[model samples]
Target: MQKELNLCWNFGCFYSWSKTLGCNLTMQVQRLESGDFDLRNRQLQFSTFQIINVVRRESIEIGYWTAKQGIFRNLNQDVSAHTYLHPMPDLNPVVWPGQTHIVPKGWQIPTNGKKLQVGVRTSGYPEFMKVERDPVTNAITATGYALDVFEEAIKKLPYAVPYEYVSFDTLGVNYGSYNDFVYQVPLGVYDAAIGDITIRHNRTSYADFTLPYTESGIAMIVPVKDNTNKNTWIFLKPLTGDLWFASIAFLIYTGIVIWLLERRIRNAELTGSFFHQLGTAISFSFFADRERVDGILARLVVAVWVFVLLIITSSYTANLSSMLTVQKLQPTETDVHELLKRGEHVGNGGSSSYVRELLEQLGFERSKIRAYTNPDDFADALDKGSKNGGIAAAIHEVPYIKLFLAKHCKGYTMVGPIYKSEGFGFAFPKRSPLVDDFSRAILKITEADAIIQIEKKWIGDEHACKNDETIISPSSLNFKSFSGLFLVTGVASTSALLITLVMFLYKNKHKMGINIGHDHVQRGHGTELETERIQESTADSNILHRMIQMTTPASKR
Candidate 1:
């Protein structure tokens, strides 16, 4: 053994034999590895004496040396009392020169090796943290997605974090809000908190949050109503407003083109009274058997227009039939704007004022906002409606909403914009070393589908009502859906009009005294005007006269 001891002679030093050596030197000392023992700054507790000896072994075991419950003397011979107990295994380096001998940083050193005091939120948000007490033994059990995740993360940690859940909700104790519950961590009320606590900027100011484990959004939940009985305008409901207007306008345009192409032909059905002629012009397609078209251009326009009409009518019939047969379920309230404009009351899940503040910021009156503590309250408020002293809708975090929907899957649904948020995370004291370790553990579990298993255990039926077709309403057919059809029909009508005009002008070229040669491009406008006048005098001249007038020079008109 190397007996050369590096002792501070100025402060004085004393040596005593080990306990087995029968020296009676009752000192609180544990075997320490070979290292520089800085006794100058260390708060020494020397109730007994310890021999400084270095024995060479096959391998060197290096670790921290902590003193607990002992007495020491300085250069002035003044005795100062301190207790340095290494309650936990040290894996990192840190020097504590104060009253308490703490373990190294990044690791926990509980006094007397006590378990960690992890505060699980009580009574408020059960979707993340749920606590139940047994009546026989009064034992508290914490369970939920958050608790599962926390336990899984703890298992992944390098060191075992011995912890017991302490619920904030107790007899005669006002649990307060989530913010207040989180604040208790800094006050040493809890070593950490695990729940559906959102990672917001304000909360992070006093506490550190782990990475979010759930979707980050606040959504609105509203009841759905069936519209199968309300079918006064069901025919119009098959097509959107723009589509209806476009269909009517194109039908009229096609009718006018057909009339123009056949009017100058002097067909018996075309020559009639003002209203009779108008009926023939527009309703000729319906009277296909009775009416006859003398112009090939008019026949082409009729065929294409009939095809377009066939597709449109078939689509409208199918849509209307489906609407009549199926249940048209729609939300009682579609969005918050509608609720706010109607002066309807809205509810928020839980007792926290965070969602209330958000609603107020969105311009909802203070009196119009109500807070529901649980899913039952939410259901009751929604059932009552604002007019009957109930809320029109309730807003809550997506996870809670999902759980609520799972229970009340029949008549309710989540709707409107999802207000973005930082989702749910575990909270710890600001800059707590355990935060990093827990964060890394969380990453491990999330990466290996462990989180998914835990979520299925807690919120597996989140999308249980997704396949209920009664809650979804089919969308109406819009103009864009048939824009190509309109384009085809419009092009066909215009082409036919052009072709018929060419035919009429060619058939009467000699009577109009117009040449078809390239040199005829310089023909005077008087010639076209006289030709139109002679045609009008002979025939009714509805479309042919207008065609000549449009082709004539602007100055001549």
Candidate 2:
């Protein structure tokens, strides 16, 4: 460790005491007059003293090997302070004759300042960078994601840094004047340009950038799909063709099953001619009246069928309600590609170089594209449509598109896959000390979820626009949805009929003249009543014996 020697070198140099590592308490006091000092490869000059750590005390200029060269390479999944700047480990140390080389920071640092001139733009990008001026006060007010990020970063600094945001004439309220802010930073017109300045190759060549505060991407704002196409068969949407046919079949099958079982018993509800029996069967299933069903089999079948019908009807009603209430919105154009294919005019902020590149790639000619400055122009363009000098879709970044959506709730929406981007970052002169400091502060802010809070403050909540369904989707039912219901009714009706038939055949076997011989009956005059009673008693005994046999254990048998 080098200790600070209290030798006055210049009028700016002051007397200060500092200790070096690995020294006994050997007291030595020395004072000297002003002299020229050199730190060029002299190892033995300051061997006895330690230079005080000025990094924390002053706005030290930190020399940096440009991290942006391969900053994005081998990027870790984690978005944290430590991983924010991918240090160039392969960087060889550089030496300047008078400049003190800051090792470990991996670059040399010289003298710097505490004051900053922050360059600002007049883009008025709603939530990201809203630059406004008061009419009466004429005071310029700056607020947005960019401003919040800049302010939050400053708050995390160990030492206070005073900065004033100055609006640049270079970026004078143009629709897409992003390059203007970046160009001014390298010219010393501003210490840093702090707005939604994307870290691109051309900009970084002349300047340095902090870890991006916001995600960078290109997106678009398009008109919400028109839902005015009235569906004539909307009622039929609750159930598909297969389900409807299956439902009708089940109802008829249930009616027929009830009629078959009840008609044999001479039941008033079921014992009728073919047409009458059909009507009764249909009524019993639809109205599901169990009171008229005389036999246990008919009642049980009707009960299960009715339960199944209840479930089916309930589901249909609920689905139908959802289908009707939710507005199925389809976009006027799916994306820029779709627009290009159809040769439809797209609206965009003409000043954007990024957008121009993207539009040209999508095959949209400059003449086919319309430039819109404000909400009124965009609204008019969208209303007119592509056929009548109108725009099929609007193009902008996600942040700007989000602001537009918030302002116009139902009229417009964002669509298409977000193009890959580097995200938004603060711009600084090449190798400025603020880069590392800003990265650190940003990490702290992100870790604390301050970014989210700031975004909510400016953009409001996204849930406000979620009330309407913003897509085109037809609502329809499928047989799979009602499979369980059909299964229940089918099984119950079949089981009841089988059980009833078994009981009936068993009870009437003697009367039907089966499994009985005339030699087993004693012939007698005026014994018909007695014979009938005997037959019934025998039938009851047989039923009891069969039931007992069924319930008896196999082991015991």
User: What's the CA RMSD for each of the models?
Assistant: 17.9, 19.1
Candidate with best lDDT: 1
lDDT (tens digit, per residue) of candidate 2 on 205-283: 9999888776567776777665744689877878999999999998888888888788778877665579888888778
**Candidate 1 TM-score, C-alpha based:** 0.68
lDDT of every model, 2 decimals: 0.71, 0.67
User: Which predicted model would earn the best TM-score?
Assistant: 1
**At residue 229, what lDDT does model 1 achieve?**
49
Clashes of each: 8, 11
Model 2 — TM-score against the truth?
Answer: 0.59
Candidate 1 achieves a global lDDT of 0.71
**In candidate 1, what are the lDDT values of residues 1-557, reduced to their tens digit?**
11233321111222332222232222232333343343546654322333222212121122223244332322233224433232223322222212223422223334334688888766465666788878898777998788889888887787556688888776335767788888888888888988878788899999998888777788899988877846687789999999999999998898888888778776777776866776787786544542487677777777888888899899999988887888766787777887888898998965656778888999999999888888888999899888899999998878788778877888888884458887888899888878888888888887888977887777664555563756356678999999999999899999988887887788898656645554476566668888999987778666778789889998888
